[model samples]
Target chain A: MFNAIVSAGTLGTALDSVSVLVEECKIHLNDDGIAIRAVDPANVGMVDLTLSEAAFESYEADGGVIGVNLSRLQDIAGMASSDDLVHLELDEETRKLHISIDGLEYTLALIDPDSIRQEPDIPDLDLPATIVLEGRDIDRAVTAADMVSDHIALGVNEDDEQFYVDAEGDTDDVHFELDRDDLIDLTAGPAHSLYSLDYLKDMNKAIPSNAEVTLDLGEEFPVKFHFDIAEAEGSVTFMLAPRIQSD
Target chain B: MFNAIVSAGTLGTALDSVSVLVEECKIHLNDDGIAIRAVDPANVGMVDLTLSEAAFESYEADGGVIGVNLSRLQDIAGMASSDDLVHLELDEETRKLHISIDGLEYTLALIDPDSIRQEPDIPDLDLPATIVLEGRDIDRAVTAADMVSDHIALGVNEDDEQFYVDAEGDTDDVHFELDRDDLIDLTAGPAHSLYSLDYLKDMNKAIPSNAEVTLDLGEEFPVKFHFDIAEAEGSVTFMLAPRIQSD
Candidate 1:
């Protein structure tokens, strides 16, 4: 029953959000909200857990899910508690399922996977153009901007078939441009957008620097990120909404 | 001037070994234990640095390259430092060039570049076969093994054209085998070797995960890792001597 995103990021530290579910002999987990699922046989190992939460209480099918005291589970799991890991165990005496992840392990907290509102509802975005580049390039751009400011502008010029990512502030300015010749593909036309250096960074998350990343852009919209999980036949995608500008 | 490889390792927690030389125009650094001669402008930036090491008691030369600390530079560039960044300006005051980054200033330290090993001589290794994989795959393999143990064994079987990566331990056991059908390409024979997981992680230092990586393997010998820094046209390599079996 320990399933749900448990991250509240400040800065510098990494973001870790995981969801895990247990049913009889099966355990499924998708950490980082990227839907990279892993199934491992429990092999008869039993755990004691009790927790409660709104996400778990709403479930009323044949079984019940509960909100776990993620804080308490964090103790047994070590520093993993900072990220809000929940744990839940089914109670035989009652139809209630007990869960504990963080510290409030009084009952299992059920979450409406659909209602939790993790991925924002992305409209049928008509991206005017796109550029596929190495994640490191974006990282470098972001870091370069970070040297001076907190945001960067991204755009593509169809005439030159060139892509530009630039950030400028009082003390420093960085501009990285690439012609169509360098990329797997570069598609664009008179469209540009500015996104939070942080959000763009979040979408990239823990992806390796040299990994291939596709950037889809609109005048003022979200960004989509996709990457592969090494040997496994799986991929993860993250789409982050854009932040409004002050001026 | 301190720029040396502790060993090949995954660039983790910190790149651990990224540095830059700062000077107004040129500062005659030392010819000591390990002094760096500017090879390409690619390895460093054209201006501004929060380098890690402090250059002290520098000797003279026609040109100068001050060895700044990598971590210190990152800290300043990352804005983690409380002290004002120490900026250096030289006046050709004698043979010694003094410099500082991020507030902590010191008289230049001199070293003989000739005295320091430029590149250690790596024997012309007769590898069984060489294969290239997306850099991230190797990074993931190391991460996967890192989660479970300190040692990982890599092997290839020619008959079926398959490669295997296995890690066995009390808490975890993982074996991943990819046949020719699943890989970019597979050349097999009885070529195999076991290396320290730590060194493999070390090779990741200063490199991003998505860069193209080539793995050179022999039945029971050192593994040489080559990384192509995407678009930079620069390459970094690590020659990891094999770990001898205790038995």
Candidate 2:
């Protein structure tokens, strides 16, 4: 059994972070909090999220896993204002989630966890470089790159101690860079990879503009983005495969 | 030659008011200001607009009419903020309009005035009931009615001295009324007519929510909406033919 009250914005952002990669997700609830892990059909992107009990205004739960359609949940959450509190309750008998905000009550049928794809193992990679910056900065870079090309290159110039995003289109190219002076934090190293902008653009939407996002990068390797949500009570990490660059 | 500088919002709103009914318009310029009269292709709606010299920051003209694509002009105007000043210069030799906002300049080719549809004469009608209300109130009623039906009935109750908007759908109906106590002004008469919601929805988007709109209604006659724009320096009147109600 799981019952909790959380801010609408928190749940909405968490759902959006995972829905971009998968339509459905198996959310594991325990006395401590909730955890979700899923991967896209193409296996090009993956998301792992955690929401501690501190994220909710009131919480009570016995460890269990429930499957839900992310899009439907997002839509219901969209009906509430960001500051509004949303109450969620699980009905074990009917296996449906009860969501209430203000005076409106919505019932969402749950999907069987057994019907969903098995969660993939999170790979551990020793990335050489780490950079932290405001979400808006990264979102702005992704938006600019999307306008110029289908793929964008992210790299760190160890010598210059700067992180840069670059894209090349048929007729135009875009280059944006920010040095240590502008970034929240940066660990200089030889890290560069090309990634599809389509996935990055979707992921960027879920990132709050004011939040500080930590990005892990390696040469020709997938990149990992980590950010806190729900006032630091929850966190989400997104991993995206790099597109091979032809010399 | 005509050269003028006006607020982006004023120009955008003016263009939108006419574009909802027609794609292209013949703008007549004179020493006093500009005048535009356009009728939709089906003659279901008509727009009469006037922008005086007081509406612009700077004005100069030799009196000429230029045909322009309203959509294209709106697009350029949209690029600027409401407070930003936009400069417009007519190039008679090239038959093009040069628009400059901030540092960006856009050139739009003019269409031949003679090739466009002729403007129709404004009909003077005697309407018994006149109601003045906030634009937001009208917009809200129209929006709610749109959700339940394709057409809406607008009328005034003589005994109650109230204005009302009603819509009946196959399964649901919406009725909204505002008596003299709630409205800015109302002159009640036996006035009632049904109108297509599709057109009202488009016209509502151009009306500023805070502006006072004067609505003139007559039994089985066109409804006329009048509102001031550009800080009273300009005004727009829209006339929509009523849809005959079936027994």
**Which candidate number would show the highest TM-score if scored against the true structure?**
2
TM-score for candidate 2, please give it: 0.54
Q: Provide per-model DockQ scores.
A: 0.01, 0.04
Regions of model 1 farther than 4 Å from truth: A1-247, B1-119, B230-232
- Candidate 1 at residue A158, lDDT? 76
Per-residue CA lDDT of candidate 2, range A123-189, in tens?
8888999999999888767765665479999999999899988877763455678889889999988
Give candidate 1's iRMS in Å, 1 decimal: 14.1
Model 2, residue pairs in steric clash = none
Q: For residue B154, give model 2's deviation from the true position in Å.
A: 32
What DockQ does candidate 2 score? 0.04
TM-score of chain B of 1: 0.58
lDDT of 2: 0.90
User: What is the C-alpha lDDT profile of model 1 across A1-247, one tens digit per residue?
Assistant: 2233322220001111112212221112222221222111321111111111222222222232223222233222342323444343455454233433232223323333333222223345667777888878777777777777677788787788888877878877888888887776887766566766755554444556777777777766666555543322234445545556556
TM-score of chain A of each: 0.55, 0.97
